[model samples]
Target chain A: MSTVLTQRMIELQGLTKRYGDTLAVDDLTFDITPGCVTGFLGPNGAGKTTTMRMILGLDAPTRGTALVDGKSYRDHRFPLHEIGALLDAKALHGGRRAFDHLLCLAQSNGIGRRRVTTVLEQVGLADVARKRAGTFSLGMGQRLGIAGALLGDPAVLMFDEPVNGLDPEGIVWIRTLLRQLASEGRTVFVSSHLMTEMAMTADRLIVVGRGKLIADATVDEFTSQGEHWIAVQSSNPAALAAILTDAGATVQKVDDSQQVRGLKPIEIGDLALGAGIAIYGLTEQRATLEEVFFGLTGDSVEYHGMLGSQNGQAA
Target chain B: MSIADTAHTTPARTERLAVTNHAVPTQSALRAALVSEWTKLRSVRSTVWALILTSAFTIGLGTLFCWAYLNRRERRGDSIRSLLFDPTARSLNGVVLAQLAVGVLGVLVMSSEYTTGMIRTSLAAVPNRTVFLAAKTIVLGMVSLVVGMVSVFVAFFVGQAVLDRDGLGTSLSATGVLRAVLGAGLYLTLIALFGLALGTIVRRTPGAIAALFGIVLILPLIAQAFPEPWDVRIGRLAPFNAGQAMFSVRYDPDLLTPTQGIFVFLAWIVASYLVAMVMLSRRDA
Candidate 1:
């Protein structure tokens, strides 16, 4: 019966998961801290879900243990009261009414019926309280899920893509909900594929790429870590890459552009002006979370599309 | 939280699990789980159809079949006249069909959580995943057993009346008549539990149904097609053949014996349940 703060923390030490021969999670070691919304983030197939599964004791970690509130999730006498999670929003039985679906879960956790009514109202499902769950919209289901997560009002709350299917309004609702939970001194961890969404919601980013922990830092720290961040709209990016490289500043190839590493604006302008590559436009760019995520995960993304659907490869 | 996002991400200062020991809710954990499950079951419109259909099919069809059989039997005179008519089989005629209903019912009880992706929500509420699973099985067992038994009883009286019209029936005093009819209720209850066991093991609708049917119907069909000695032996081990043995007035020497049949049936149920429990223990929600 330890508080989440006094507990040993939700630690993953040298965790690895292998399916047949392929490694799904490779030597993952990170602590999801209390009182902050730690974004359990990665592009598709980066093993974010796999890692979460390990923490919850859903997937066996081949190498080490993932302690949730000092003990494994299974070891907790009342795991529900300790940590609440939303792995998938639509995991409810379609035939069940939202009320019934929540009721079953409430009963299992030993919550009262009045609490069920309270949650239904909290999630804004009170209007359709008696309706079957199968008929609910995606946003409605997400709301119901959020209500269930709040039912135990646990200390540690984890959400895997809680906004995946929500509309704009639902999205805003989740953002506020997560922020509120964290502010209330509860640990809130959420995983998402969208960097934009995470940018606005998560306080810390645990970026994973190709089953490896690529970056685990605050947004400022992550962006600042990469020295090579440049925004240039030029007629000659090829010539720019050469000019920036020759000046002793390592130029990293970015999408349809180039990043001048270890160089200030004056240094880049001096090199570009001397090299006869007339830069139509050159702007100093502070690293954004998106740039850092894409830069770190560019090579490992399974698919890339024009829309934010995929990261680097075509389907 | 980060100091830079100044918009949202704030430096994370670690904290306690909200309040304290006295902060725990008044109701216990298990009671809450049961309440949630009850709400889940009654809230669904399909639950009503699923339960009602099983009883009506088993009982109603049982009476109709008995009436038809009696009419045919009256046309011909046969020794052991009363024994020739097995009200047990007639009363339990709907068992096969109702089993499918409850089987789908049971499969959905678990697999639907996976299908709809609700297991995460369920687990989040009650983080002890096995406790969530156990609570579900308990609910399923309670409802299905009650319905299965009730359906069997209704089927018995209705079928008896129809058979009596053709002068081929006797009162409950008839030798094995009462035992057969009542045994059928037990049989349906077991079948529903069998479905629960299969649901836990297979964890999918098609897979669970196919597996249940394969053991109950397909394996028997395949075993019967076998040439000789191996045929009778393998057929007897199959679940349906063994479990259905009690329904017969006189045991078929070619098939599994009465006591052996029950043992075999019980063995299949126990083995499935154990496998399910072991599997449930290892997997994360």
Candidate 2:
């Protein structure tokens, strides 16, 4: 496993896809290394699926290359052995039984039927192996997709929006499965628009916006980069706001509280104490992962809701 | 990177195989794809049902037609043998209906993948586009050929047996009789390939079927409306009429010879396949 992991890596360099006048994926580059789950974060139409398709050689890149372990995916003699990807779990014939569906895929890659049975057992679909895939619940369908990815037992695995419609139990199952794959030294790259899913499952993140790279960093780094603010509640709000503005801290009044930036909670406390003003409360407001995601993708969101239109008031 | 040390319940045997340095000796790319396609073709209920209907119509309708003809002969007080009526062709009259069944089967084999988005998974596993397409063709062609031949043979024998009771049937040992049966099967196979090519080109079930039926069935009828030498000239070139020339026992001035008819059928198949290949190779899945 270690030997396989050391040699397997996915690299994309200046990869671009254009459909007539629209640029789908524009000049994006990233490397997915083994032994970790790298979350690919992007909004809808951000080229996440396009990039994944290019990596699998399903769609050609108009400009650059997507390489797996130093070679194009098309060049690999045993593609499934090198990389097993579940681009869309629903990409299967509904009329086929689950076992037969996986069997054909396994046979295409020269994998044994025995492995098909094993994967069925592993995904907990053993009892329903003879059932038609069309009848499966969304969670069962996802499990079947993961079974296909593991059929070849490839060194690299990719799942696009794997937990899209899964129940809480199914989502937890996928999280544990992804972590286990990473711990086994497989390069596990998963793509999703949901930030919370990535926060719980991903060790590193490559965030994209408007088909371009926005942030590629560790989860800790990504979360910490969002600006933090210090919130202070004071009896004399206008005087405290003036003092905070004078002290080089940006202040915004919200209801009865004043939000201060560029200053720590202790610093704001000290300022209020020195100015002979009583502070009701001082709290540090750290940005949540969702906020960090929105901040990075604010301008790139193709479909965004109005900030305060829900209540017909501006924020 | 320590899969061996993991405490998860994944099968230990597969882990060993996964960690191995070399792949097991497997079939070549094309052969494996063929095997995969064969597995896929047989596993689907649609394929089985389509082939069953093809057989049922070919044999069932053939018997019905022969029985109806026998009743008409009795009423007319005609002799058992008629020089004008070709017993061989009448025994295989079911080919007309079976053609649609075989054509639909061919279309579904390729079009279902497109509709269900299974083509992406298929192409990802077998990246060589030409090889993948060829494998699909091989599997569909072989299955259609075998089923078509069996269905036509059953139709011929059963229809002949019904006619034989009145001493009006042609035997398999007869020279033109065997050729007609074999030709009917060949025609069915060619029609299936034609349907498959159109399905690959159109990438939709209804559109491809409509195109296939339009060219093979409707165009022939439309061509008959033309004036002067144009009708016979265009009619002979129609794929369906040209292929029917294969089963004819007597020569007609308006119809093509067996050899010429086969060439025209082959031409249509090759043309459709070339167009399909170009489209499949160039397009994104």
Interface RMSDs of all predictions?
A: 8.2, 6.6
Candidate 1 local Cα displacement, residue A149, angstroms:
1.3
- Per-model root-mean-square deviation over C-alphas: 7.0, 5.0
Residue-wise C-alpha lDDT for candidate 1, range B122-142, written one tens digit per residue: 665566655676677677778
Quantify all predictions' global Cα lDDT against the true fold.
Answer: 0.72, 0.85
Per-residue lDDT of candidate 1, residues A226-296 (tens digit): 54455665667788777777777777667766666677877777777777777766677776677777888
Top lDDT hit:
2
Off by over 4 Å in 2: A1-4, A233-247, A255-257, A264-282, A305-315, B1-25, B73-81
| Weakest lDDT window of 10 consecutive positions for candidate 1 chain A | A1-10
- Candidate 2, residues B157-215, lDDT tens digits: the string is 99889989888788888877788788889999888889889989999999999998899
Among these predictions, the greatest TM-score belongs to 2
